[model samples]
Target: MIEACQVNRSTFFQCLNGKRLPKESFFEHLLRTLQLSPGEESKLRKLYHIAQIGESVYQNRQCAKKCLETLAALSGNLIPQIYRLDGVAQLTANWASLEGDNRVFQELCHLVQAEMFLPEPKIDLFVPQEDSRFIEYLKVLYRNSGEKNVRLRQLVQFPQGRGKKTRESMEFFDSILFFLASDCMGYEAHYYYSEVDFADTVGVLYPYSVITSTGVLLMNEAMDRALFSAAPAILETCRTQFEDVLCKTKQFHTPFKGYQQTVDFTLENWEGTTMGYQYFATPCFSAYLTRELVDKYCPAGMEERFDHYFQSIMAGVFYVSFCSEAGLMDFARNGLMNEFPERLVPPLELEDRKTVLETMLYRPPENSRLYLMDPEKTTVSDEFVFSLAKGKRIMTYRKRLPKLRMFCFQEQNLMDAFEDFFESLPESSYVLPRSEVERVLRQAIRCCEEQMTFDLSNQIG
Candidate 1:
């Protein structure tokens, strides 16, 4: 097989033995040599990437994968339980004995669980950095808290301010996507740009703490030693400290519950908002929506609100959107606006689709980009829509729910991470490039025209 691929056997063996990562050429050669099926080849490629990048990357990847999957099917039964983070008891015991490295984390988790039982429960967290597993776990805890209303106000410090880069910070930014992406009302974060210069900085005793109803767990810069106490004076002091710090921080994100809130926020922040990249299951229907069509088809009570929302998008801005090929084809076939309520708004006519496509093909809006991602190549669910504005906000909407819910995030690090994530998506023929977008739209227009002609002929007949 090595001779067939004309590769060195020693290098191949080394890669197999986990002593070295396989080169891209060797990996592709091996795939071809085995004549693996497309599915198997895709799996091998993912495995190869994981091997090349190390487990830290995969750890975050798995968190995203799990979060996306959970969010896609989010409903009555599939909702994550308001549960305890496993090993809290053990970790508490370890902490009591001063035995384990993760005792602080476990104790923190236990406090969160205890707070769930209290009326009007609140948690204040001062996080200096991101821990992937812990963040994912906290998301579950907060998300599942639901009606219990366990509000968590987290004050995060970005390492970027210090001009130092690390994998943990990157993962933290990645986790912030779902942290703000969901419908969870309890989770709120405020972030400040600062380096932890505790020696020079006065009055900040510990850099991290989890303040709960049960107790306040304070950890120093290293997180090795902690002071946990339930005394009212101590708790009040910590709470005051947190509030003082929070006053100096900017809000990370905000939630827009329904149509009015979403529209108001969008319109308020519309000016100078450059869309970094948007991922939707279907082509953005709102962008091309006409006022006439909006008036004609908008649901009885929602006409004014719907018109304002559509107008905001049509107002013009620099933006790029990523959509699915299947979704584009679906739009071409049915002209349905999947992002909005299906029952409320009627689908566009064939002529309308034609105009939209022609406008896209010939006089494509300046500073606007449209690309179609191969649905199979992308991990995003059809139910989810993620929109990012450069250094401004990240807005995500889920269509499956009854109402129009959107999470608008203004956190700088989150905006940065999402911008990086979107820009980093591999552009290929499948994930159509911006340059080739006109060609694809032209094809869709032709399809629309062909269908129109067929309908016309049938009507005449």
Candidate 2:
């Protein structure tokens, strides 16, 4: 490969092994030699650019930190900038005036074309309901592509309880049914009922380009005045936020037949198993909520309803989790303590009881398989816990948050990646049988009493 690219073997090896950055020309030549497809070439070019920046920043700690901050600002630009309207009209006019000269629009067009080639590419749209031209363009692209590798998630806002005709007029219902029936493309549509007044924004995200309202044009509102970006970080941020909204928002299912069933099935079997349960665990203000606290926190006139519905749901979940932990404690006392009684140390003087319990709860189990992924990082969330009770597999992906991407059976490669990710989590635990429940409880009570006695003795001394 080095000879073919007309580069020295040592230099090629250095670049290949990340010992050094190759010249831009050499890198392009290497890509050509590898016969990379257009999409792969684009990805490699972006990666190369990032690598160049990374190499420069690696030399200086302050510069690296500043670079990261700048990157974060760029990624989060979508959030703060979306609300700003100052000079939006002038900017839109200027952008629209560019017409054919707009490189970003051209790039979007190229991306729309490239998406046809991707196997199960995701396309997320948050567009105005009246924009027929853009919708038509998408339909044409999908029809002509003749490829089934597409998952489209669209978010549209509607007037509460009176948007049936509006939706039908826009062919929104028709499009959803068409895509759902399509053997190749998976479809999901969310309808946001605006309870409060807010500025309208339109966005469309594909694997390559993210297009959003730039506040640039006044004349044509049909995505003509929107800003487009191919920057990976920005696209990723947009995609992530879009998925967040989709998951939390209500779906437009009234006019669309079988819509609810489709969504329910998708979420239920999302991880490809009915038995597995995934929990994104974060620190709650308090694990156990008192009646007084619930009354204080919950709104008046809604306290009873909330307690009956939402509170009950959460209480059941907390109860199950508490019971699970208690069972583990029992197993520790009866099974673990019997085997390794010397390992248990009494709490030291002035040591907090809470601290001791936490330590005991987090201690690594013996006679079990252990696998650790990377250390917990990222402030987004605490942990992603996946438990397969039937399979006796429990894994916790610490310091990682779930991405806004959709996974289907057809996207086997992506599914495999998820499987590997779940398998890589550090923590695992097994379920104890119902027959052992009584014994587990008894052991747990004894352990608690022993700890109380030890702490009382230490205080007396």
Candidate 3:
């Protein structure tokens, strides 16, 4: 700031952080020195707030870790407060797992109390909850944990005992969270205690609820809501549950079907590959714990795969540049993706984006840009998008008539791109083409606009 404004360092730095205003003479000198425009000033203001928030996360690291430590120690029944304090605690747990901070973990555990006592805070649930049955199961499971088998069973049976299966400890987190997050047609609370076998893999129970022609938009609208509401929870639960399974499973009755066991990958044309190991053994369990052991005790091969993730994300962008030209990404499919569907625009500050744009209209023969420019080569493959993360075909369609194949190519590119983008970041916010890194935000804005339109239309009608 000082160098740009030709002002003294102290005042310039202080001003940026909103610490103190410089003297009029200082301000005049600084303003003239910088030659800023009104629009630039506004952008700078926004950036300043973002930077502040980033700093706060750094500061709160210890708090999140504490939350998690608390969670691991808790053995009592589930408190209703768990539901109430859901958001912030969930955020902290996820942050701790990814960032490895005691503060966030501690904050995660503290959530049990927060939800019980604190009024719902000033935030929305990204992943909406439809049925409370799963929450009920959670409550039961929490209470049952340390009890003798008989007492544990007795505790769980208290929640009306209508659910079909005895709440397996695994199912407590899996079936419960999945049911809460997903809305399968044939699957219901009734199905849980009954004989109906609705097919789903991992935790998801896919319904035969087919979207009709007239209901296409309706399905999309409902989908947007469900995904928005449950995404955070889904991601968080999956991380915890799978990591727990990975970390603790010396012996188990049920096999660890890879995370994408039930999803079809035929969309990208890479359909036949059966993913027995990677998705289940690692992807679902220890994303942050990469293969190459960093320091002393991390996973092996994490660092290598991270590089591949970057390549795939760029491949996603390359596909977007060719298919949409405008850099827009479309919704891929259900049960398979963690990110909202949309293409990422490169940021001005990003050297990668600069390199991409430089080669867009013209580039050397061997350049990747030349390959991306090809409509044929650039097209997303049915095998890529439709195929499961490890190449399995989805056996069931949850919502839409499994309009699964129409855009599998883009979705595959999207899936890998997201993997690359997310895996590379230190925190969720770094989960940007990041807001910090993204130069072009039109794609995100478009999603927001579309969501608002659906909301308004629903409200008006």
**How many clashing pairs per prediction, in order?**
0, 6, 67
- Between prediction 1 and prediction 3, the one with superior lDDT is 1
Cα lDDT tens digits for candidate 1, 352-460? 8787777767766665567776545444456666667677776766655454566776655445555654565543333656655666777788899999999999999
Clashing pairs in 2: 91-216, 92-216, 92-217, 93-216, 120-149, 148-184
Rank by lDDT, descending? Answer: 1, 2, 3
* Model 1, CA-based lDDT: 0.64
lDDT of 3 by residue, 199-316 (tens): 3334442221111111100011122211111245454554354334334322111111222321222122222332311111001111221223122221244344334443333333
Best by TM-score: 1
Better of 2 and 3 by TM-score: 2
TM-score of 3: 0.18
TM-score of each model, in listed order: 0.67, 0.29, 0.18
Ranking by TM-score: 1, 2, 3
